[model samples]
Target: MATIYDVARLADVSAKTVSRVLNGDGPVGARTREAVQDAMAKLGYVPSNAARTMRSNRSGLVGLITGAITGAQESARPFGLPDLLIVQGIQRVMASRDMTLMIADTGGRADRVPHLVRTFLEHRAEGLIYVAEYHQQIRLPQVPDATPLVLVNCFDDAQSPAVLPDDRQGQHALVRRLVAAGHRRIAYLTLRADMEATPLRTAGYQDALAEAGLPFDPAIVRIGYQSDEEGEMQLLWDAIDDLLRLPEPPTVLCCGNDAMAMRVYGILRSRGVRVPDDMSVAGYDNHRIIAETLYPPLTTVELPYAAMGMKAADRLMSLIAGQGREEPAPTLVTGPVLWRDSVVERRAATLQSISL
Candidate 1:
């Protein structure tokens, strides 16, 4: 393998000049920098990261921990894959700074985190990011005071710096748009009642209805599923039947995610209900696989998984640079609602409640 000395000789410069160009530490003439790069490319020369780290007295390594599996799972959730997407986002940002990213998948085991953390610290990771499969709460073992640690899609009572999706805001925006489009009697088919996003999204739905002077009809709200089990599809179908049976059926059905929305599409088609012509639909988490596949593509909100990952890395880097806030409040990233062919403008009279 070609060394820095060989590159310097080919470029007609000193090894220190090659180092300067590689590390971007000190300025070299633009011509000299170009020549060095060309020479290195010609020789397929790769810089030694270990040598660079040792010289700088910093690891230049960031550690990421997640509960997501590397392969297909028997119990994977529908819609977005926050863990994998977040890691990809983090890696993208770190690569721009010439930092190495080390990832550890715990295989859905929380008990493995502490061991992973210790191993990362042993390798002198400059920072750490802990990501969860979804937005939830968690507790972790004590980390060294000096190490910069950030949480993504999860939080603890300790109020450590965290980055999360603004689910409530995203839902609120979606609902508000629907309301503005003259949709009054909107049905909400929710996800698992126990998940943190469930209540937050419900609140957003209620907020939009209240703002639009629409009555909050409990009958139109249905808990579609408690988990991503195949058995839950039956419950969703039952909820749809219940909603359609109402005296004044909803003009639109807002689903928890695109996967659920796709299921709704199949059920509605089976009943001869043309989407946007007879009933409209909207969903969250713009999982392209589900959202874009429906006859008329599903309108939904982006989950902002990658955005949260990038933001978490920014915060981690801030802490590493000794610029952390006095009180590190949770940072929220909101995704814009994606408009598609699934929904349509409705007449005001079509949204009125029917007499019992």
Candidate 2:
């Protein structure tokens, strides 16, 4: 129940000075600032966010809308990497700026977003961030009176500022690496057609193949719903069977994500297929579990999830400062490929058909 007055009295400074330090409106002497901070810390002072909103008409809070924590029946926890990492990054930046975060869960239901936005607005949240369960098209809720908003990992054709991993770049980088290592017949295991990220990644894969002058064969690509790791394993096994039966089976397999790559490893091991010898594998989204658990560490792309969160927070802060929202174009962030033991060089094919 410590108030600014109590802190000022204890620190022997005026309440206005304390307020200035708290709000960062005007500069205070270092010694005075330190004294006030120490006194506030000793008194366990907590600012009333509600009162601040009432007085300033700004909550200084950013609302983050996420998908429900629990995954659907067969779906693995959607948006795991982007959700965790992006939040971490956002928190890091917000801490530095002395801001607060509010969260809402949509559970893969688009209808829930408007309610969440209204709640955030009711609470006087200064800005909003809409995060999706997966890389899918988003129909965003209209912010009341043009409230500042940003989308995370979801793009709306109507135009909205967003932060998401550059799947196309990541995919091309992955394939280019594998191709240079001598993998000509690279197989791509991807998610179903409904997902936007799937197509972007698929396009990148095709671009890589075309650049390498490798014939694009529909048979080498397998697409299925990504429900859970166990279910994906079954689908992956079936896909592997189909691929292995081909006259020219791929030596390297590029998966859509780390989870799928893990399943690929399990299926390959069960069938006595040597990793990086008989076949190599790579994937996007460097999930912590997959990176550390596999016998041979996975070579995957590290999505800048935390960075995305941090950037979103920064942009939201700008909006809250009355700077206005940026144009409604999603910002693409590129993730770097993490080289690991999962891929090996193909020494046999020195000269092959190179695409223009």
Q: 1-356, model 1: which lDDT tens digit per residue?
A: 99999999999999999999999999999999999999999999998877877788799898999865553264455655446788888888888888888999887778989999999998889989999888899999899988888999999888889998898999899999998888878999998888989999999999988988888999999988645457778988899999999999999999988878888898899999999899999999888877888879889999988888888888888888889766456899999899999998764455553422
List residue ranges in candidate 2 displaced over 4 A.
1-55, 68-82, 107-111, 228-231, 322-328, 348-356
lDDT of 2 by residue, 1-356 (tens): 99999999999999999998888789999999999999989999997767657877866677888863433333545323646566667778878987788877777676887898889888877778876656667787678655778877777876777777788888988888888877778899887777788888889888988999988999999974456656766788889999999998988888878877877788888889988778898877888777667868888888778777888877777776767464446778888888899887775545444331
| Best model number under TM-score | 1
- Looking at model 2, residue 75 earns an lDDT score of 54
Which lDDT values do the candidates have, in the order given? Answer: 0.87, 0.79
Supply every candidate's count of residue pairs whose N, Cα or C atoms clash at under 3 angstroms: 0, 6
Q: Who wins the lDDT comparison?
A: 1
